[model samples]
Target: MHGKTSLIEHNGEGVFQGLNNPLTVTRYHSLVIDPPTLPSEFNVTARSASGEIMGIRHREWDLEGVQFHPESILSEQGHQLLANFLKR
Candidate 1:
Protein backbone atom coordinates (compact mmCIF):
# COMPACT_ATOMS: atom_id res chain seq x y z
CA MET A 1 0.00 0.00 0.00
CA HIS A 2 1.58 3.30 -1.07
CA GLY A 3 0.51 6.79 -0.10
CA LYS A 4 1.47 10.43 -0.66
CA THR A 5 2.11 11.72 2.86
CA SER A 6 5.33 11.01 4.73
CA LEU A 7 3.52 8.67 7.12
CA ILE A 8 0.86 6.03 6.47
CA GLU A 9 2.78 4.87 3.46
CA HIS A 10 2.68 1.08 3.40
CA ASN A 11 0.65 -1.61 5.06
CA GLY A 12 3.39 -4.14 5.62
CA GLU A 13 7.16 -4.00 5.43
CA GLY A 14 8.57 -7.27 4.13
CA VAL A 15 11.58 -8.15 6.24
CA PHE A 16 14.42 -10.62 5.96
CA GLN A 17 14.47 -13.53 8.34
CA GLY A 18 18.20 -13.88 8.66
CA LEU A 19 19.88 -16.70 10.56
CA ASN A 20 22.18 -14.66 12.77
CA ASN A 21 19.89 -11.65 13.23
CA PRO A 22 16.31 -12.54 12.72
CA LEU A 23 14.01 -9.53 12.35
CA THR A 24 10.97 -10.66 10.44
CA VAL A 25 8.29 -8.16 11.37
CA THR A 26 4.99 -6.88 10.01
CA ARG A 27 3.22 -3.52 10.07
CA TYR A 28 -0.32 -2.22 9.78
CA HIS A 29 -0.43 0.91 7.67
CA SER A 30 3.01 2.10 8.68
CA LEU A 31 3.64 5.75 9.23
CA VAL A 32 7.38 5.80 9.85
CA ILE A 33 9.75 6.79 7.10
CA ASP A 34 12.91 4.93 6.24
CA PRO A 35 16.12 6.86 5.83
CA PRO A 36 17.37 7.51 2.32
CA THR A 37 20.89 6.39 3.04
CA LEU A 38 22.37 4.57 5.96
CA PRO A 39 25.81 5.22 7.43
CA SER A 40 28.63 2.76 6.90
CA GLU A 41 28.25 -0.52 8.81
CA PHE A 42 24.56 0.10 9.21
CA ASN A 43 22.51 -2.85 7.97
CA VAL A 44 18.94 -2.75 6.76
CA THR A 45 17.19 -5.62 8.48
CA ALA A 46 13.81 -5.11 6.90
CA ARG A 47 12.26 -3.52 3.83
CA SER A 48 9.35 -3.77 1.47
CA ALA A 49 9.48 -6.24 -1.41
CA SER A 50 9.59 -3.29 -3.77
CA GLY A 51 12.83 -2.16 -2.04
CA GLU A 52 11.22 0.47 0.14
CA ILE A 53 13.23 0.70 3.36
CA MET A 54 11.54 -0.51 6.53
CA GLY A 55 13.93 -1.23 9.35
CA ILE A 56 17.57 -0.39 10.06
CA ARG A 57 19.94 -2.10 12.42
CA HIS A 58 23.40 -0.89 13.41
CA ARG A 59 26.10 -3.52 13.15
CA GLU A 60 28.26 -2.45 16.06
CA TRP A 61 25.70 -0.52 18.06
CA ASP A 62 22.57 -1.51 19.94
CA LEU A 63 20.49 1.04 18.14
CA GLU A 64 17.69 0.11 15.79
CA GLY A 65 14.71 1.62 14.02
CA VAL A 66 11.47 0.19 12.67
CA GLN A 67 9.55 2.07 9.99
CA PHE A 68 6.25 0.40 10.85
CA HIS A 69 3.53 0.24 13.42
CA PRO A 70 4.59 -2.76 15.48
CA GLU A 71 2.41 -1.66 18.33
CA SER A 72 -0.88 -1.28 16.59
CA ILE A 73 -3.82 -3.59 17.11
CA LEU A 74 -3.92 -4.25 13.42
CA SER A 75 -0.35 -5.50 13.49
CA GLU A 76 0.03 -9.26 13.25
CA GLN A 77 2.86 -9.69 15.69
CA GLY A 78 2.65 -6.43 17.50
CA HIS A 79 3.01 -7.73 21.03
CA GLN A 80 5.56 -10.33 20.14
CA LEU A 81 7.67 -7.78 18.27
CA LEU A 82 7.80 -5.47 21.25
CA ALA A 83 8.58 -8.37 23.53
CA ASN A 84 11.49 -9.39 21.36
CA PHE A 85 12.81 -5.87 21.34
CA LEU A 86 12.63 -5.69 25.10
CA LYS A 87 14.43 -8.99 25.39
CA ARG A 88 17.31 -7.77 23.28
Candidate 2:
Protein backbone atom coordinates (compact mmCIF):
# COMPACT_ATOMS: atom_id res chain seq x y z
CA MET A 1 0.00 0.00 0.00
CA HIS A 2 1.06 3.62 -0.51
CA GLY A 3 0.15 5.39 2.72
CA LYS A 4 -2.38 7.53 4.54
CA THR A 5 -3.19 10.41 2.21
CA SER A 6 -5.70 13.24 2.60
CA LEU A 7 -7.34 11.73 5.65
CA ILE A 8 -9.57 13.40 8.23
CA GLU A 9 -10.21 12.62 11.86
CA HIS A 10 -13.55 11.30 13.05
CA ASN A 11 -14.81 11.54 16.62
CA GLY A 12 -17.99 10.48 18.34
CA GLU A 13 -18.85 9.45 21.84
CA GLY A 14 -15.17 9.37 22.77
CA VAL A 15 -14.33 7.25 19.75
CA PHE A 16 -11.89 8.63 17.12
CA GLN A 17 -11.14 7.56 13.60
CA GLY A 18 -9.78 8.64 10.23
CA LEU A 19 -11.65 8.59 6.91
CA ASN A 20 -11.44 9.42 3.19
CA ASN A 21 -8.27 7.40 2.99
CA PRO A 22 -6.47 4.48 4.51
CA LEU A 23 -7.40 3.97 8.15
CA THR A 24 -4.38 5.10 10.18
CA VAL A 25 -3.86 2.88 13.20
CA THR A 26 -1.10 5.32 13.98
CA ARG A 27 -2.31 8.51 15.59
CA TYR A 28 0.50 10.47 13.97
CA HIS A 29 1.98 10.80 17.42
CA SER A 30 5.32 9.18 16.61
CA LEU A 31 6.55 8.27 13.15
CA VAL A 32 9.37 5.81 12.73
CA ILE A 33 10.17 6.80 9.16
CA ASP A 34 10.82 3.73 7.05
CA PRO A 35 11.67 4.88 3.57
CA PRO A 36 10.92 2.30 0.90
CA THR A 37 11.39 2.59 -2.85
CA LEU A 38 10.82 6.32 -2.34
CA PRO A 39 13.81 8.37 -3.33
CA SER A 40 15.92 10.33 -0.85
CA GLU A 41 15.85 13.60 -2.83
CA PHE A 42 12.09 13.51 -2.79
CA ASN A 43 10.42 15.52 -0.05
CA VAL A 44 7.85 13.47 1.85
CA THR A 45 5.06 15.42 3.49
CA ALA A 46 3.54 14.39 6.78
CA ARG A 47 0.73 16.64 8.03
CA SER A 48 -0.34 15.08 11.32
CA ALA A 49 -2.39 17.92 12.69
CA SER A 50 -3.11 21.56 11.83
CA GLY A 51 0.01 22.29 9.78
CA GLU A 52 3.37 20.80 10.63
CA ILE A 53 5.89 18.18 9.48
CA MET A 54 6.44 15.38 11.94
CA GLY A 55 9.98 14.56 10.91
CA ILE A 56 12.26 13.82 8.01
CA ARG A 57 15.40 11.71 7.68
CA HIS A 58 18.14 11.97 5.11
CA ARG A 59 19.43 8.73 3.63
CA GLU A 60 21.90 7.51 1.03
CA TRP A 61 20.02 4.62 -0.73
CA ASP A 62 16.56 3.88 0.74
CA LEU A 63 13.04 5.23 0.97
CA GLU A 64 9.81 4.95 3.04
CA GLY A 65 6.30 6.26 3.55
CA VAL A 66 3.19 5.66 5.64
CA GLN A 67 0.90 2.67 5.48
CA PHE A 68 -2.35 1.90 7.26
CA HIS A 69 -1.89 -1.84 6.74
CA PRO A 70 1.03 -3.82 8.10
CA GLU A 71 2.98 -4.61 4.95
CA SER A 72 4.78 -7.94 5.12
CA ILE A 73 4.50 -8.74 1.42
CA LEU A 74 7.88 -9.83 0.19
CA SER A 75 6.87 -8.90 -3.34
CA GLU A 76 6.28 -5.35 -2.20
CA GLN A 77 8.76 -2.77 -0.98
CA GLY A 78 7.76 -3.25 2.64
CA HIS A 79 10.94 -5.03 3.66
CA GLN A 80 13.07 -2.41 1.96
CA LEU A 81 11.26 0.33 3.79
CA LEU A 82 11.54 -1.36 7.18
CA ALA A 83 15.19 -2.15 6.57
CA ASN A 84 15.80 1.44 5.62
CA PHE A 85 14.25 2.76 8.81
CA LEU A 86 16.07 0.24 11.00
CA LYS A 87 19.34 0.58 9.12
CA ARG A 88 19.33 4.36 9.20
Candidate 3:
Protein backbone atom coordinates (compact mmCIF):
# COMPACT_ATOMS: atom_id res chain seq x y z
CA MET A 1 0.00 0.00 0.00
CA HIS A 2 1.07 3.59 -0.59
CA GLY A 3 1.36 5.50 2.70
CA LYS A 4 3.23 8.00 4.77
CA THR A 5 5.13 7.77 8.03
CA SER A 6 3.50 8.85 11.29
CA LEU A 7 2.89 8.03 14.92
CA ILE A 8 -0.44 7.03 16.40
CA GLU A 9 -2.23 5.94 19.55
CA HIS A 10 -4.79 3.26 20.22
CA ASN A 11 -7.66 4.51 22.32
CA GLY A 12 -9.29 1.96 24.62
CA GLU A 13 -12.49 1.99 22.64
CA GLY A 14 -13.07 0.96 19.04
CA VAL A 15 -10.86 -1.49 17.14
CA PHE A 16 -7.76 -0.63 19.09
CA GLN A 17 -8.93 -1.64 22.52
CA GLY A 18 -6.31 -2.90 25.02
CA LEU A 19 -3.66 -0.69 23.42
CA ASN A 20 -2.43 2.82 24.00
CA ASN A 21 0.94 4.09 22.92
CA PRO A 22 2.66 6.56 20.59
CA LEU A 23 3.23 4.01 17.88
CA THR A 24 5.05 4.55 14.63
CA VAL A 25 2.61 4.26 11.75
CA THR A 26 2.25 4.37 8.03
CA ARG A 27 -0.80 6.20 6.72
CA TYR A 28 -1.70 4.65 3.43
CA HIS A 29 -3.18 6.44 0.47
CA SER A 30 -5.31 4.65 -2.03
CA LEU A 31 -5.39 6.02 -5.52
CA VAL A 32 -8.40 3.96 -6.49
CA ILE A 33 -10.36 3.90 -3.26
CA ASP A 34 -11.70 6.94 -1.51
CA PRO A 35 -10.92 7.12 2.13
CA PRO A 36 -13.80 6.53 4.50
CA THR A 37 -15.51 9.50 6.11
CA LEU A 38 -14.50 9.20 9.73
CA PRO A 39 -16.44 10.52 12.69
CA SER A 40 -15.01 13.14 15.02
CA GLU A 41 -15.06 10.65 17.87
CA PHE A 42 -12.82 8.22 15.97
CA ASN A 43 -10.41 7.71 18.80
CA VAL A 44 -6.90 8.86 18.04
CA THR A 45 -3.92 7.72 20.03
CA ALA A 46 -3.36 9.81 23.17
CA ARG A 47 -0.29 11.46 21.69
CA SER A 48 -2.17 12.35 18.53
CA ALA A 49 -5.40 13.51 20.18
CA SER A 50 -4.36 17.11 19.61
CA GLY A 51 -4.59 16.71 15.82
CA GLU A 52 -4.11 13.43 14.01
CA ILE A 53 -6.27 10.67 12.59
CA MET A 54 -5.01 7.35 13.84
CA GLY A 55 -7.74 4.79 13.34
CA ILE A 56 -11.19 4.68 11.71
CA ARG A 57 -14.06 2.25 11.56
CA HIS A 58 -17.11 1.76 9.39
CA ARG A 59 -19.09 -0.61 11.58
CA GLU A 60 -21.93 -1.17 9.16
CA TRP A 61 -19.42 -2.41 6.61
CA ASP A 62 -17.12 -4.13 9.09
CA LEU A 63 -14.16 -2.08 7.90
CA GLU A 64 -11.51 -0.45 10.03
CA GLY A 65 -7.97 0.90 9.70
CA VAL A 66 -5.13 1.96 11.89
CA GLN A 67 -2.72 4.62 10.65
CA PHE A 68 0.14 2.87 12.35
CA HIS A 69 2.35 -0.09 11.51
CA PRO A 70 0.74 -2.44 14.01
CA GLU A 71 2.49 -5.38 12.39
CA SER A 72 5.90 -3.84 12.44
CA ILE A 73 8.42 -4.79 15.07
CA LEU A 74 8.71 -1.10 15.84
CA SER A 75 5.37 -1.18 17.60
CA GLU A 76 5.22 -2.43 21.15
CA GLN A 77 1.72 -3.70 20.54
CA GLY A 78 2.34 -5.11 17.09
CA HIS A 79 0.98 -8.54 17.94
CA GLN A 80 -2.05 -7.09 19.68
CA LEU A 81 -2.74 -4.87 16.76
CA LEU A 82 -2.96 -7.81 14.42
CA ALA A 83 -5.05 -9.77 16.93
CA ASN A 84 -7.49 -6.91 17.34
CA PHE A 85 -7.97 -6.44 13.64
CA LEU A 86 -8.28 -10.12 12.95
CA LYS A 87 -10.74 -10.60 15.76
CA ARG A 88 -12.93 -7.89 14.39
Candidate 4:
Protein backbone atom coordinates (compact mmCIF):
# COMPACT_ATOMS: atom_id res chain seq x y z
CA MET A 1 0.00 0.00 0.00
CA HIS A 2 3.09 2.21 0.17
CA GLY A 3 5.77 3.28 -2.29
CA LYS A 4 9.36 4.19 -1.52
CA THR A 5 10.57 7.76 -1.84
CA SER A 6 13.61 8.71 -3.93
CA LEU A 7 15.35 10.71 -1.22
CA ILE A 8 17.95 8.46 0.41
CA GLU A 9 18.19 10.82 3.36
CA HIS A 10 14.44 10.91 4.03
CA ASN A 11 13.52 7.67 2.30
CA GLY A 12 11.54 4.66 3.53
CA GLU A 13 8.51 6.79 4.37
CA GLY A 14 6.22 5.73 1.54
CA VAL A 15 2.95 7.63 1.35
CA PHE A 16 1.95 6.46 -2.11
CA GLN A 17 -0.83 3.92 -2.54
CA GLY A 18 0.26 1.02 -4.74
CA LEU A 19 -3.23 0.42 -6.12
CA ASN A 20 -3.26 3.85 -7.76
CA ASN A 21 -3.29 4.02 -11.56
CA PRO A 22 0.07 4.31 -13.28
CA LEU A 23 -0.70 7.72 -14.75
CA THR A 24 -2.05 8.93 -11.46
CA VAL A 25 0.98 7.57 -9.65
CA THR A 26 3.31 9.38 -12.03
CA ARG A 27 1.42 12.61 -11.47
CA TYR A 28 1.68 12.11 -7.73
CA HIS A 29 5.43 11.80 -7.90
CA SER A 30 5.62 14.91 -10.03
CA LEU A 31 3.47 16.83 -7.57
CA VAL A 32 5.66 15.78 -4.67
CA ILE A 33 8.64 17.28 -6.41
CA ASP A 34 6.86 20.30 -7.92
CA PRO A 35 3.74 20.95 -5.91
CA PRO A 36 0.77 22.64 -7.54
CA THR A 37 1.07 25.39 -4.96
CA LEU A 38 -2.27 26.14 -3.43
CA PRO A 39 -3.27 29.51 -1.99
CA SER A 40 -1.72 28.70 1.40
CA GLU A 41 -5.12 28.87 2.99
CA PHE A 42 -7.61 26.36 4.38
CA ASN A 43 -11.11 25.93 3.02
CA VAL A 44 -13.31 23.32 4.61
CA THR A 45 -16.63 22.20 3.24
CA ALA A 46 -19.40 20.43 5.17
CA ARG A 47 -20.71 17.10 4.03
CA SER A 48 -23.51 15.02 5.52
CA ALA A 49 -22.91 11.44 6.69
CA SER A 50 -25.39 10.10 4.14
CA GLY A 51 -24.18 12.54 1.53
CA GLU A 52 -22.56 11.46 -1.76
CA ILE A 53 -19.18 13.10 -0.97
CA MET A 54 -18.11 11.29 2.22
CA GLY A 55 -17.22 7.95 0.62
CA ILE A 56 -15.21 9.38 -2.29
CA ARG A 57 -11.45 8.93 -2.76
CA HIS A 58 -9.00 10.10 -5.40
CA ARG A 59 -5.36 11.00 -6.11
CA GLU A 60 -3.33 13.36 -8.38
CA TRP A 61 -6.24 14.38 -10.56
CA ASP A 62 -8.36 15.02 -7.48
CA LEU A 63 -7.83 15.43 -3.76
CA GLU A 64 -10.13 14.67 -0.82
CA GLY A 65 -10.09 14.01 2.90
CA VAL A 66 -12.58 12.74 5.45
CA GLN A 67 -12.80 14.29 8.89
CA PHE A 68 -14.73 11.28 10.16
CA HIS A 69 -13.76 7.66 10.16
CA PRO A 70 -17.46 6.83 10.16
CA GLU A 71 -16.70 3.37 11.51
CA SER A 72 -17.27 4.36 15.16
CA ILE A 73 -18.34 7.16 17.50
CA LEU A 74 -14.81 8.56 17.47
CA SER A 75 -15.75 10.81 14.59
CA GLU A 76 -18.99 12.07 16.10
CA GLN A 77 -20.05 15.18 14.18
CA GLY A 78 -16.69 15.11 12.44
CA HIS A 79 -17.72 17.99 10.22
CA GLN A 80 -17.24 20.20 13.25
CA LEU A 81 -13.59 19.20 13.30
CA LEU A 82 -13.11 20.56 9.80
CA ALA A 83 -15.07 23.67 10.71
CA ASN A 84 -12.92 24.40 13.76
CA PHE A 85 -9.69 23.71 11.94
CA LEU A 86 -10.71 26.18 9.24
CA LYS A 87 -11.67 28.90 11.75
CA ARG A 88 -8.05 30.17 11.83
Please state the error at residue 6 of candidate 1 in Å: 15
Tens digits of per-residue lDDT for model 1, 1-88: 3322222223222232211122334454546444554677767766565566767777787777777666665554557666667766
lDDT of 1 at 49: 53
Quantify all predictions' global Cα lDDT against the true fold. 0.53, 0.34, 0.56, 0.25
Ranking by lDDT: 3, 1, 2, 4
- Counted clashes in each candidate structure: 0, 5, 2, 0
Global CA lDDT of candidate 2, please? Answer: 0.34
Give the TM-scores of the predictions, in the order they appear. 0.60, 0.24, 0.56, 0.19
Clashing pairs in 2: 34-64, 35-63, 35-64, 36-63, 36-64
Whose lDDT is higher: candidate 1's or candidate 4's?
A: 1
Off by over 4 Å in 4: 1-42, 47-60, 73-88
Candidate 3: give the clashing pairs: 9-45, 25-68
lDDT for each residue of candidate 4 in 1-88, tens digit (9 for 90 to 100): 1231211111111221221211111011222211233223422222232221222223332444433342233333334434433553
**Where is the poorest 10-residue window by lDDT in model 4?**
4-13
Q: What is the C-alpha RMSD of each candidate to the true structure, in Å?
A: 7.1, 13.2, 5.1, 15.9
Which rank order by TM-score, best down to worst?
1, 3, 2, 4
